[model samples]
Target: MSAAADFAQDRDTLHFRGDLSLARLGSLPDQLDRFDGRVSRVDLSAVSRIDTVGAWVVHRFAARHNAQVEGLDEDSQMLFDHVVGAEQPVAQAPARPNGLIRFVAEVGAAAVQAGRTMYGLLGFLGATTIAFLNVIRHPSRFRFNATVQRFEVVGVSALGIVGLMSFLIGMVIAQQGAVQLAQFGAEVFTINLVGRLTFREMGVLMTAIMIAGRSGSAFAAQLGTMKLTEEIDAMRTIGVSPVEALVLPRVLAAVLMMPLLAFYSCMIALIGGGVLVWLDQGIPPATYIQRIREVVPITDLYIPLIKAPVFGAIIAVAGCFQGMLVESDAEQVGNRTTAAVVQAIFMVIVIDAFFAVFFTWVGWV
Candidate 1:
């Protein structure tokens, strides 16, 4: 038979009878709700069998009515005592402070993370420097094949996209500059604008951005995958330095190829601008060339060329460092790859700004 509780109320006293187990707890709440005024005490002598559920009901009733409980045997008394003790109030959560305090706390956390990232970057840079020196000391130890392969991957394979992007950018700059300069009757200065901007800033900047998005992310993904597979650890076990074998080749390729790529980007941009000016302003190719020669000095080319290898090194290091940071998970590989590209692009822009300020102060531009 299922357990049941019979509650008979008389003024300030209530009587509990029958089985007082879980199967009968359902009716107890309804019967208790029907009671009026105060229940001073509950008599439980008639409960033939009592379980934890029944003890809980008695405990709740006792708490609600300030009622004294009586007539429980040893097992029932133990359960009733335990349930009463277990019904202690839950501690309230502490209230949150105002928004300004939370904002400051968040800013502090961000600053801490930024500091860690910078420290890790410096450590990776030092490791790469030592690896380069070691390779220089023993040229035979260097991975020539890997360097060449990365050069082809990062340079040759990137040509078409880089060309198209730079070309379109140049055409847009020419068209926009010509339209604005026309009001001042200085439309021919579009050639000067395109030449200076393309060679000195936009060409290399856009190229680095592209390479960061393409090659930097690829580096992180490749290295992260190797890390996940324990291949880098395997290389270490075999007395191979991953810095030299894996990182050096990619870094070297970026350093060697970046200047060449920047030069190509500048040339294609200038050509695109020339073509646009010829069509829009009826300026001949020779006239545009003469204007470039007259207005855009060779010194302008030096800035971008000087910046290229540094930017490439930043991209490569960011990618490789982030890849090395990856943990043993597929999701972490993707996250690190995305982080590498974002960090590379951000570093490239920051470095470019610093270089611009330094060059302006030193009379380089």
Candidate 2:
């Protein structure tokens, strides 16, 4: 039978009967309002069975009316006591601080997070340096095969896209600079502008940005996946230094490949600019070539070579650092990969700017 509640006005009692379980709770009184003032006692002698839900119902009714429960068997009373004992008030969260305090707190938290990220990147850089030193000390320990494989991926495979992008950028610079210089009857100077900019800054910067998007993100994703699957942890357990085996090869590969890539980029960009000038200004190829040779100094060529390896090292280190930071979450792979690209590009540009300032101070420009 379904459970029910009834008020016995004659005895000032609330009565429960039948199977008092969750399945039969619908048959109980819909409201306890009637028991508020009049009811002083509850009679549970006829309850055939009760569960936690049923016991809670009865307990609530009795508690509301300050009524005494009577005639429950030992089992029913125990169930009632257990259910009532388990009930607790839910705690509310504390209120947030108002206005400026909240804003300041958030800003402070962001600053702290940034500081931690900087500290972590610096630590990873140190570890990678130690790994590099170890490899240098024992050439036999160097992962030459792995480094060569990475070189193919980071350098050889990247040639087409980098070449295409550098070419387009060179054409744009030529078109814009030629149009402006034409006003001053100096349109021929486009060759000089293209040669110097491509070699000294644009070619290498573009290549670094591309490499950061490609190789850096790949490094982060690869390492982050290894981290997610506990492969990195397993390597540690087996006494394999992941930093030496994994990171050193990638960094070395970047260092080896970046200068070569940058040189290719500069050549392709200059070729693109030369083609554009010939087509647009009707300048002969021989004259353009001679002009570039005469106008662009050897120092411009050497500066990019110096910047390439440093930019490559920065990209590899930033990527690997973010990769090692991945927690056990799979979503973190994408996040860290994105972070790697952003960190590498940001650092690349900052370093490039600093180099510009230093070289300018030394009169290299």
Candidate 3:
């Protein structure tokens, strides 16, 4: 039968009695943890037998109290010495900071990350500018065939969906404007509302959003895949400038086609609004068209034509920047593609707002 381990303190010495083996440890380890008193010495004379585990516990308790360990047999003394030599403190997890501190730290980290992202994007823009300059200097470096293919991909292929969305959006706007204007006996003004809104803002804005999601994501995914396959690396090795070969063609196509797409979107939206006007207000399509011509100024057309190419450039640049940043795996390609769409859309909206304010200030409102 094994004797249970026990401990007591007296004469400023902690005495451990009974068999101090691991099986008999019981609550002694815990008691040692809770033990409090002046301990000048550890008396294990009464300890019947001790295992390595028991020797470790005794040695630790003695060290914690800075007490001298005494009354050990030769074997126990050797075991205690080994335990002492082997002792090493374990690493503990850091304590958590309070909420306010953590919040500040997180915000600071996010701000720093955003600054870095802006810096990288600006750097990429500068590099693209230099590449474009080089292409201008050597017109033969301009890849006309690649630009043609990208035109089909980014512009022509997107026409159906973009046109359909514009039509539906225009119908909704006309119907809603008609409903509100009917209350004022000004239902005819729905023509002006739909015409001016679509031509000046919604046409290009919605097209930009669509392009960011469709073509921007495609750019990121395509470039990301090329990077993953090391094809971009191979091209670089062969003296091919990826910016000119890949990025420029996409960027040029987007810039050239955006105006055309926006114009198409505006016309389709006008037709959609004309249809709604005829059905809802019993106004004839010709009359609705005439009213739109009278109410919507030439300045309305200037806005989209001015903004479309910039929006296109922003979308392409954002997509290519995110794509170039992608690394490691297919998962990162998907992530960068998502980031590209979000960044492109966000920038488009922000830039559009600034343009709106500027146009208003310039009396184009």
Candidate number of the best TM-score? 1
What TM-score does candidate 1 reach?
0.82
Candidate 2 overall lDDT versus native: 0.89
Model 3, residue 288: what's the lDDT? 88
Question: Which numbered prediction scores highest in lDDT against the true structure?
Answer: 3
Ranking by TM-score: 1, 3, 2
Instruction: Give lDDT tens digits, candidate 2, residues 219-280.
Output: 99999999999999999999989999899999999998999999999999998999899999
User: In order, how many clashes per candidate?
Assistant: 0, 0, 0
Residue pairs with colliding backbones in model 3 are: none
Model 2 CA RMSD to the hidden true structure, in angstroms: 4.7
Segments in model 2 whose C-alpha atoms lie over 4 Å from true places? 1-103
The count of residue-pair clashes in candidate 2 stands at 0
**Compared to the true structure, candidate 3 yields what TM-score?**
0.81
Question: What is the Cα-based lDDT of residue 247 in candidate 3?
Answer: 93
- How far does residue 215 in candidate 2 sit from its true spot (Å)? 0.6
Across 59-158, the per-residue lDDT of candidate 1 in tens digits comes to: 8878788999998888888888888888878899989988999999999999999899999999999999999999999999999999999999899999
The candidate 1 region of ten consecutive residues with least summed lDDT is 29-38
Who is ahead in lDDT, 2 or 3?
A: 3
Error of 1 at 92 (Å): 8.4
